[model samples]
Target chain A: MSRELTVVGLSHHTAPVEVRERLAAAAADAEAFLRRLVADCGVDEAVLLSTCNRIEVVTCSKAGHDPRQALTRLMVELSGIGAHDGDGLLFAMQGREAVRHVFRVASSLDSMIVGEPQILGQMKQQFEVSSSLEAAGPVLVRVFHKSFSVAKRVRTETGIASRSVSVAATAVDLASRIFETLDGRVVMLLGAGDTGETAARHFMAANVGQIMVANRTFETAVDLARELSATALPLERFRQYLPLADLVVGSAGGGQLLDAEDVREVLRERRGRPMFFIDLAVPRNFDPAINQLDGAYLYDIDDLAAVVEDNLGERRREAVRAETIVEAEVDQFWQWFEKLQVVPTIVELREYADSIRRGEVEKTLAKMQAISEEDRERIHQMTRAIVNKLLHHPTAVLKGEGSPTEESRLLSAVRRLFRLGDDT
Target chain B: MHTHTLMLFVASACYIGASLCYGASFSRREAPGARLAPWLLALGFGIHTLDIVRDVVSAGVLPVATFAGGFSFFAWLVVGIYLGLQARLSLAVVGALVSPLAFLAVTLDAIVRGDDVAVPQALRSPWLPVHVTLAFLGNAVFALAFAVSAVYLLQENLIKSRHTAGLIRRLPPLEKLDRLSAGFLMWGFPLLTLGIVSGGVWSANSTGHFWTGEPREILAALTWLLYAGLLQLRLLGGLHGRRAARWTIVAFSLLLTSYVAVNLLRLGTRHGLGLAG
Candidate 1:
């Protein structure tokens, strides 16, 4: 039986990063795990794919074997977790869904860094490893090649790739596009947390003139200040440079990075030189009302994620184009698959028809007292056409449903109806 | 004439078949079936060989005396050279490129074919074939350079977008396309110069004036100068890659306008230009 292609997995939509991080299959483990899978679960063929965002196992088997249990067992063994702990987290797909899953993954639809373009390489590497192990047979080979073709076609045919945004970097580009220069821009950090540190490093990378680190603590502020090559300021004194720094990043110890009153005081002090406040906090450190201010543009983590997510959403929108591309590629693979079946059926049908035509033409020619050579040739052509017309529809239908599952029944029907294999 | 027409059919069929096969190859990487490209290309060359030989059948009345015959020959050369390069380098995208070019060249070359407008006595000089053939071949090379540059611009954009589509994975890099375009022009320019020079000599002897007869010849010379400047800039100032590719494309567009479009407009300065017009 030809294994159908299938996919089963969850992305950021179904799981948080912490959960995803735990599920991520390290590179070295995947190969060993692929070997263990065949040994443990009677896996005939298999390829393991693990990206930062997605963990999926594609496999084929023969005879009596449970795949979902087999995959779940492999995950537990590789992850060093309780075997049952992964039951709810691991997704299992059987046939066509498995093939379709890999296609989508190769197309960047299953990426954590959506449209970041590294997953295709990762998939190719995994495919190579599988090929090395002799785990991917002909069907898997067709699936991979067709997936690559679909991804290629999607990129060329659709505008999904045309629009993309890196929100973290977009803030910088947008700021520069607005102000025309980041050379002398004063960037203030509101938090001493990682998100704030990321913003500080970006500003430093862009060569911003100065940075002011303001945190809830005087000491932590000093540490961040020295690291960023900027002066450390107390939280109370944060309003002093509010009018000075053109860009502000919030990454503080407090759950809420910044409040509305904090921004209102700064906006009042700035006299409106245009300030961009980038909020890199989860629950939002600043009140969204700060966005309502006249010259201050305040954006939270969700807004930034929204920008990347919008592109991810755009890619999701384009997944239809990607799916359309995959559909055509799938059909092409199927056509080859189908034509292999059709060729034999066509030859058999033509041979069968030829025998009847030849028999009738011979009998008629023998009986004819005065048939010209031209008349005989004409009669032969008429008999051939009638045979072809009579058999065309049934032969086409027979080949159309020539899957081995359907072919057995159809073959029996053809044999019994035509007595094809019976000797007179 | 019947044989000539049959050979034309065979040539065009080979080109069309070669195009489809290569296109399938790009979309199907693992399929050994797409290996038909080399054979189809060889087939085209075989048929094209027959067509060119047939052209020589009527001796002095060479097939290129008609406009279609000349363009078709040039088309075959472009595709033939493209196939040769592909065989040596394993470049698959050349089919995506060189096939359409061969098609257009053959199609356009055949456009004014049936008319067989007699060559004027003045243009019937011994050097006329050499001059005309060289110019058409040079234009064909420039057309190739333009196609390569177009791919360069697209690959550059794909890089900028940071999207590595499968086609992007399959395509030669922008730098390679740029170099190929420059290489084409590098050789093409000198051939064009010889063509123009031979024509200048022919015209001076027979018609008395070259550029004065066709103001467009001056345009062609200027186009040639632009490419010469580009080649010099490429070597001397390291102005290459897309910049050289751009200049080649620009110069070719002007060459095309001067050679084909201007003639179509019947814009000329010669007293006998009116005779052809």
Candidate 2:
């Protein structure tokens, strides 16, 4: 019998966070759930993937049983939600759709933030858990392994994950556009606002030469500097170090700290080296007119957000290319799976032919008691060869080269023609 | 057609093809033809080099003696230097900017058709090749600087305007472009100074005068002074980025105008190559 793959899950797309949290199982609990699913839920193999954004129960069942109804019931019970509520939240997919779902999830195409890297790791962890519990059979193992490689192909072949999508990341991206490498470049944080601190941390990660924290409150500056391993300076003395900064992020709450004239003086002192100013302040710390300075570039919070939006749009376009890759891979995997489905029908046909051949040979030998033992053995061998030759063409048509649709059709036709029971 | 002309045509076709590929790679989100463009450019440069060598061998002189040969040699040097720098820098967009200029220069060479000009009696000296080569090399370096500075301004405008989109990522950083432009100026200034000095000595030996006060000589001197001033301001006053880029464009425009006016139009008494004759 062919085993069918099925998935019943709720993701951020279908379920609210409150419902997902209730359905989300711990690692040990998920393993026990897989055990129960395989042992008593009419599932031959099962894996439960639970993350903060989603909870999916992937199962392999024999062709005769519909495990979806049983699995959905268990999920509703697990969530402690009403049956009607669970029906709206959980999505059920079987056969090729299930395979595609697994691939898309592993590739992060189905992620809340598309092209994020954490989904594939989370899937692999759950797959390993199921395998160690012996709840994952050959089919689940092959499907999970293929999903990993598909995710890798999607990552390398497409630009889905190449651009930065967050505000802090967008600031780094803009910084790189202005400067060649951040290796020896300096970044100054003016006021130690939360958003500015986040952007500074990103620059630090990019290996900026040094980070300076200057705030109106000197102690606050010192505290942030200690945490970030940077130098702290009083706000009054920040002008002394302004010329050294390649990137200056302003999060100070006060209005218009640096005017156009002040920045022009700084540019002259630095010898016209470019300075990128990210203004994350609410009331605007740097003068907007500073952007007009020849070597000074100013981007406020709204500008940074606009860049992030643009990057997200680019990622959406790349995701279209990634979806095409996933579709092709799914077709390839389904062909292999359909070929596996033909194996059982071929075995059943061979067994039926051999049984008839053995019965005819025995009956004939009983009637030929006057003949020698050598003649009897020769007769049995002759019957066996005739049966094998007659069955070869039928078996080859069922098992040999054809499309998945053609193979499945041939499998059922051969099964019925040979009177092979579907039970096996 | 002669093999020399046929090779030039083929090389020009390769450059055009490379430029289109680079344009496609730059304008699109995906860099599909980025790898193919370098190979196409290298092939064109190789064929152009061979064509120049053939001309030098057959004529028994460096190919800069005629207007056509000088234009072709200038294009060859530009492509050669760009290819060399492209090996080390991630500046593929510069190729898109440069290869079209090369194609245009080659096309200008074909139009002038000055390949059959005989070497003048006064010009038959070892100093002719030396002076022309140094001048052309400096001009080529400045041409590359011109393209780099153009890119720097484009990138700077995009960053300042907050339109960081598809084409900006393909371009090198502004600081790198600024630094490269300055480096080109520093190198080209000396070669140009030497070229002017050698031209003076050659003129004294051939015409019994060191200074001609001709239109071409004056323009060349003016071009040299402009570059010298720009380089001095860059080195000492720390003038870089947008202003430096604008100065480079202005200087190159002057150099290009002088070449077209004095060489192609035959405006000056000396250094015209006598294409009309």
Candidate 3:
């Protein structure tokens, strides 16, 4: 049997969002679409991964058939694009390259954000969908399982997924370092500016206890607070509420909202519980000197940007290590797959020899009627041993390590010499 | 070698291993060492416990009368308390800071004395064991507090200065460390008070005096006063965070200084007894 693996996909790296969105939208009925592809195309096993960032089809084919051309046409049709236009948007890989592409995609190395964690979960969901629909066969099941482990290894062994690369995320990361968990902690939104609001939203996602939005315009504060399901306070009285806040996100444009003395008073009132301040205003809302205070941590926009830059650099270094791990794992998986190719031939050869030996022994026993029953049992055992001994060397030779081409050639030669069927 | 000495050597070796493993957890990316370190420390703790029991059973007295025995007992108490706290808090970095201190104490004990010393006739009293045990236990708790305070200060400085790189994550949260330091101080202060009272009782019974103005006595009084003042400030004055951590460190330093001066150096005490015993 000539089993081949193939992958065809378009990601953020290749196609624009418009192209990816069309295919992703078309995959709303993913199970039905995947089942149809497996039935219509030459694909024996198929999995479709459709996310906002990418749409990919992973398939296994047999009997010397390549599924890439069929899969590409289906992708073009689903994307609702012209065939000529789809040529450059979609990339195809076969054999070892295809297996490596699936691994890299599952591991998030092929993601727009190189080390983002969502792609692995998306891959797992798609794999589960296909397997549940019976569209994924044994081969794809093994491939997906191996890819999950490879992704896990990359995550643990390398620092690829360890740090935050965005400014808002970095603020939350820093806050977490100061406080063990953000749960039940208060957040005071000093201004309703976009940057500060974005960071506050990130804090809210981390399960902060309450959000108090204070904007210079009382109506703006009320509107924003209503949208966020938070409490609104007049900006003038924000100082009174400062002690209640564990994290202060400032984006109110203007010079110096609160100085060191203001923070010192609040820190004393809070009884030395640490307070983290993220100042997103251009002219710096909080005094830089507040950072020197014992329980007060102040970071301006520039500081958060610097931390994000540093984390990005760290992630890039870790990505290189992850790529090395992916390559090593790909090689190991490919070796196992190549060895799997000769398994059918080994089984067929054993069955062919055993059948001939059993038939000849039965015919000979029918002629030798004078032979004792014990002697007949001994003869049957002898014939079984002789057949096993005769086939041992050839079976070992077929299963031994060899290049892919050499293994395929040897398999074909054995099939031809034994006059075995061509269905395998 | 005697079984007692052999056990001590084995225990010391285990602590050294634990120290290196805990230290490795800080620098390495994959911290397999962190997982192994606690097991090594526990093994050493068990063996050290057996050795202490053997000393008490064979010698018919507490094993803290000599300088070597006092250091060894103090090390055991520190590790024992740390292991207890570790069950509740994930303070691996504190372990890195603590195991080396344990190793140093055990190694010093091994080097300073080769054989067990009998309790002197003058020192053999009911109050001797009680006083020494309370005092060393108090010192052990304070030693742990000192380690926690050091971590708190480092973590607080890193967060305040905005230099929190990878090392910040390895340390516990600032608030957690501060609270832990205060908890240690709260437990230790009462123990030290009882220890000081028992020591006074022992001194009066042995020397026929309720008060002695030796340098050792004065140093102990000063150390005790500093801790008492800190506790008073923290409990009544709302003192916390950096100031509280600093005070705890300062008071522990004085206690350490007094121990070295009076017990190891034999500076001013007429009786030359080691470490409260």
CA lDDT, every prediction?
0.66, 0.85, 0.85
How well does each candidate superpose onto the true structure, as a TM-score?
A: 0.45, 0.88, 0.90
Candidate number achieving the greatest TM-score relative to the actual structure: 3
Decreasing DockQ order of the candidates: 2, 3, 1
Candidate 3, position B243, lDDT:
90
After superposition on all CA atoms, what RMSD does each candidate show versus the true structure? 18.0, 4.3, 6.3
- What are the runs in model 3 whose C-alpha is more than 4 Å off? A344-396, A401-424
TM-score of chain B of each: 0.87, 0.94, 0.95
Model 2 lDDT per residue over A75-146, tens place: 888887899888789999998899999999999999999999999998998889889988889999999999
Candidate 1, residues B1-277, lDDT tens digits: the string is 5655666666667677778887887774445546786677678677777767765654554455544565566677777777777866566777777766676656565444663445567656787767777776777777778778777666555433334334555667554676677788787888878878876876777767655645667676787788788777766665654455667778777776665644556566342331111
DockQ-derived CAPRI band for the predicted complex in model 3: medium
DockQ of 3: 0.60
Which of 1 and 2 is the better model by lDDT?
A: 2
Candidate 1, superposed: residue stretches over 4 Å from native = A1-424, B1-49, B59-62, B89-94, B108-111, B115-117, B161-167, B208-213, B269-277
lDDT string for model 1 (A1-424, tens) is: 2223333344565555665666674435666666776788666677766666666677766422455675666565555556666666667776445666677678776566445567788888878888888877776777787777767666666645654466666566445533535887899888777778877887788889999988778899899888877999988788767778788887665566556677767665654345777878666667777766544567677666665665666666766766777655655565555444355545665787798889988997999989899999999999989998998888777766556546656755665576553445
Candidate 3 lDDT by residue in tens digits, A177-288: 7887899999999888788678878988999999999998999888888888899999999999999999999899777899999999999898778899999888889999
Q: What share of the true interface contacts does each candidate keep?
A: 0.00, 0.82, 0.69
Q: Write the per-residue lDDT of candidate 2 for residues B120-169, one digit (tens) a residue.
A: 67667777778878888898899889999999999999988887877778
